[model samples]
Target: MAAKKKVAVAGLASVLLVAMVVAVAVTVTKKNGGADSGAAPVSTASKAVQAICSPTDYKATCEQSLSKANTTDPKELIEVAFNATIDSIVEGIKNSTLLKQAAADDSTKQALAICEEVLGTAVDDLKRSGGKLSEIDVSKVDGYVEDLRTWLSAVITYQETCIDAFENTTGDTGEKMKKLLKNARELSSNGLAMVTDITSIISSLPMGNVGSSRKLLAEDEGRILYHKDPSEYESGTEPKFLGKVSRQLLAHVKPNAVVAQDGSGHFKTINAAIATVPKKNNVPFLIYVKAGLYKEHVEIPKGANKIVLFGDGPFKTRITGNKNFAGGVKTFQSATVAVNADDFFARDIAIENTAGPEGHQAVALRVSGDRAVFFNVNIDGFQDTLYTHTYRQFYRDCTISGTIDFIFGDALSIFQNCRFVVRKPMEHQACMLTAQGRVDPRSTGAIIIQNGDISAEPAFLAARPPIDAYLGRPWKELSRTIIMQSNIGGFINPAGWSPWMGNFALDTLYYGEYQNRGPGSNLAHRVHWKGIRQITPQIAASWAPGRAFAGDYWIRATGIPYVA
Candidate 1:
């Protein structure tokens, strides 16, 4: 009797699957002006497509991209959208290959080569997003949505990164590449919008998580917290809203490999120690560097997963390099330290680039990993410093110093109890601390600096009068950044945020401040741009680690003291 019941359930599921496939076929036939020969009404799939694409910015692109989907399931439809984006990007890569072969000089050819690489990365990101979407648990839609948003945002940034590589190259190669990618970019943006709209789409459907709603400001703007006195703390003492992991935890960490410049440990160079790390590690592979200065470009390469890199202290143990764009390396390759694997953790170390202000685009640290955490570390450089290159990242109790656009990237990152030290730039060049690259509205990538400090170096503070500084400028069209509950130094410009160009991204970007302190936090003379928002605490909380990056699930596993 029990076996018969199981067979009945299996047969029912098969029948439902056949019905869904027929519904999808009917919708596609109607869309293509073919005669509908199925009993399933076409409106079932057509209405679903309309509802999903309605929330997207490029409605036509979203609808047309999903027109050939083989299933009426919303999840399968999104997979179809991702597959369409991949097809478009593959075509873009082919065009880029042809253009690179016809380049007039080495510079143009190199730029085209960078384009091909980044575009390939973009395709990889979309493929990953599709795979994640396929494994989504309906009960945990919020967490899955955040992960999807981060990956899709990286896809948009990769496309823009390809275009930025052509800044110094000659000819219409850059323009030509842009034209080829126009459709792909639109499709990617539509993919993000569809993901953002997934909650509503699921709620409308008879789903398990229909009762669970995303905690966003639009739904609870009435719950606002009034500001307290910024003077509660002493003038020079920084406010502490979140706690840090104890130094005792560091003493307890046992190392699998040790690196020291004085030959007192397992390996003298950091790379040598990394080479010994076990491949395909399922657990943390601990590596400790004692105390000394090591000068070499270090990369925690892809597939070197779950590496724990610790040092004695930031000043006592340091890694430095001088690779810059002017030094004939690509900006993506100029990092003194690059973490390209997932679940990477670095503690109590310093990574810097000593190329000075003359180096056009030197990077101190470039992190292109998922779930990467940096604690009690110093990342210092002149320009294009700490590149939060991609993925979901967390930085706590870290100090990052740079001159212009020092902290930049498309990562969905949160900086808690961190410090942003603005250094002096070249003659007549103003300092802009952050250059966030969030190109799509639905991309969940944002720079959230809460319970932190933003001040200038002593020399930069006393620079010439015309050498001013601003919080940040938009590096992409839909860039998003928020400076909340932090101390902003008086050296910052009264306008707070700077513009990339004349009115560009001013009306499209998302810039906000909530309950910030210090002279630079004043909003009396702040920019009255459409993109800037006087956000509420509710909105600020929405960007917190627990909600924004789904930190509650993964952060604690790293033994990091996060306030999620």
Candidate 2:
């Protein structure tokens, strides 16, 4: 069965590549004029632009963005596209600033503020995409292309996030913001389309497997689950995957600063300790947060890279707040602990948004940094608990508890040997483990839960309310998530998944499950949506920490052991 599915997918890939190649050829010929035609030959630069942009979704935007590039190189053209996307985002920021200043109501003002912040993020991602494009190694073009697509897809997610923040705002601000960002979003999509084309052609060829060689389209097999006592999993010791280096770093390394609330450390607050760190730090700025209940909000701003934050334990040392949509704080700005820089490492810590279910869209831990790692931590909230905002992240042996859409974001992340706790919610409030927002099909943004545990809290189980809970719903058009080798409790709805809107993204989103255990893992009554399926072991492996995002590129440095 797997072989047949592989053959079908390969055939489809071949047809797609042939179509795209034909399109490029026809476009180049048309632009160069036929051999018999008496037209002047076009410049090599013009031909390059035409060929590269021909198969893109937004050809006009692609050509216009690359029109100024005089080089006859495809890579140069892509770089120009990235630059154009950056320019468009910059312009959008300007417009958002003007709108914010002119906003009358507080809601409009706050939403516009979010737009400004996310637009800056979009610019940063575009710059990173451009840098990656410049550093591509032709011999390993597959990896480079995958990286480019991931970043570009993130660029699109950032723009859409900006626009989505304007929902329910007064006036035509949302519409205006959407219009302003149309070009930027289109350019980003075009860039992703081009990058995907590279891998698509490679996969269609006979060349050895390069970057996700298989495009599995097999149906999921039904499985019977033997019910287990939830108490066993809850009481079991959490599996530790921290390597020797990580253990040493967390246990023996002296912190650069200490944050204590009892006036015993260098600083009394996390933010104060963060202020002492050098800007654009290239080396690790370690901070040991002493055992105390920190009630203040914390933010690790951009440029403060390689910050190592650890604490006594999840219950001993805690950082928490109550910012939420109900309190007029924009969801993007409501995180209790927001990590916005790269190479962020946190261990034995707990972050939470104390906002109850009534306080909707309250984010507990929001991470936007690339290559961020969280181990032995707890992210607790009611509505939106852990927000994997953007970039690449990994969480191990951590407990993330929430009510609705608890684990949500648009990042490429993996949860290995972690515990997903579903807490009791307001009446009739369904529990959603994740709401991944991968809008771009080419984007590598996904949530992969490997060897994890998903169960309800004791209070939730005691209530025994008919509160339906599912694995996830389509948060965006191309939302992608996979649960592999995990234990799902019976509290989860029999369907296994839910829908965001009335069949809005049911056909486009990608949800896969493989080799899962527990009663909830049964596939007999799972949603039969077009995008949901049971994937083969080979397909599941592609989403592993090693294969998904450049093998051990960032994970090894973080000292986190992974299933390679």
Candidate 3:
């Protein structure tokens, strides 16, 4: 079965090479005012003639044209040079015996298919290459040009060898062709591997450093100073002009009530307040935190279910910490806010980890709750900022910011009408919105961004990378994420999804996009992944907050009453 598939693939590749060759011939001849005679017949002499007129023979001419054209528009010249090289190789392959053998070999169809697939990918790489080159520093352009030239030369040689092997059909010739096919496959794999490596290296190069002024407010400076204290914080026992309130106001509040830095004068640090409540008790605990800066790390253990944390205001209440994975911490252990408890609710507060660009996977908020909710909140960080670690979670009217893999986790979560601000990375600009790690195929975990605006801090960084950045990447095998009815900004990469770590993950991950608008929502250049889905409005609607995947059980846990 495998052999047959290979043969079919080979046949398809042969046809594509033939078509490309014919197209280039017609285009060149027509441009030169020559008679548009149909493709020349395939023969030994024809193959010999083509080999003699290899791309090498015209290398000088091609280079001269490219140089001249590049002076006017380097991008156009590079594209022309690239296409011409491909054209030369395709033309050479069309009349070769390899094309005939590929068409005849049923066992080698899958191998041929692999060739075609690689070719298609190469074409895309070429297109993306132009923009990629532009992003490189001027000093590195020459190096890139030289490398591309060398790669192209090797590619042309490979094509020629494949052609020559195809032409020979005798016992020895057939064996030779099979060997050539194997070599061709290896070359394709190597080429792709090189491209992936080079692209990653280039993408990670620091483009520019993020300005220090753009950093989030420090824990000490983020204290809430409201003009008038709300009645909710005032208790009968406390009565002074701008006086502290009693804990009585928290009586009606649930036992696991969560108090932020902006709450009544009760607790100092936010973590201290979170620690005051028992993890397993059903009895409600009132955690009233005074309005002040609380620079502390907080984690609610697994048994600590049904906890609530209230704050004075979303912007005023601040919980900040910073830890990064590169500092020898596992990605899971680098979170500032790690909530393992189920039925957790937080409102009117901001949770942030200030680990800068140097920190790789420092998490600001890690929620693994079965049913967790965040309302009128803000989560800030760079890479791996907000970790919806596991289970179903919901966020309503919140703000989130990050750089690479900012919003990542292995959970089914929904962000409704939230603001996503992408902070540009200083080095090679690769900012991703979300990285969902849903390893289980049966576990339908996802990150759904519904009705949001993708904004950026720096005005220049607002224009997302052409191909370097992505809306998201699948951190797990069956990972799924969707952006629906959102105002996507220009900062989004044209290829909406990026490889998680390498191409291997691309095969197993499920990434999708639906009903997104604005400059960043262009689907023309999206990655052609088999698992990437194009969802319909109905399908997207089904994933809505009150719908199947995110339903009443999840919504009610958020403490916000939902009709559905």
TM-score of every model versus the real structure: 0.83, 0.86, 0.53
List the global CA lDDT of all models: 0.79, 0.80, 0.56
Ten-residue stretch with the least lDDT total in model 2: 217-226
Give the candidate number with the greatest TM-score: 2
Residues 37-112 of candidate 2: C-alpha lDDT, one tens digit per residue: 6776666667667767876888898989988898655556777888888889899999989998888999888888
Q: Write the per-residue lDDT of candidate 1 for residues 136-210, one digit (tens) a residue.
A: 544445556667877888888889888888887778999999999998999999888877666434324444432
Flag regions of model 1 displaced more than 4 Å.
1-52, 200-253, 278-280
lDDT (tens digit, per residue) of candidate 3 on 1-564:
535533443343344335434655555567666764574444432222222222223333444324424222223334455555444334333323354454655323323433443344344334445455444432232234333432332242233223332232333443544444443333333333333333333334442331121121111111221112445443453322111221322322222333434454445566666666674745334453444557778877756666666666656667788776656454556678888676677766788888787887788998855567787778998888887765567888889998888887656678988999888675666778887765434343678888888877774364444325578877656667888888888767778788766675677776677878899888898899888877987888788875534224334433353333
Which of the two candidates, 2 or 3, achieves a greater TM-score against the reference? 2
What is the Å distance of residue 62 in model 3 from its true position?
63
Q: What local lDDT does model 3 show for residue 123?
A: 42
**Worst ten-residue run, lDDT, model 1?**
218-227
Whole-model lDDT for model 2 versus the true structure? Answer: 0.80
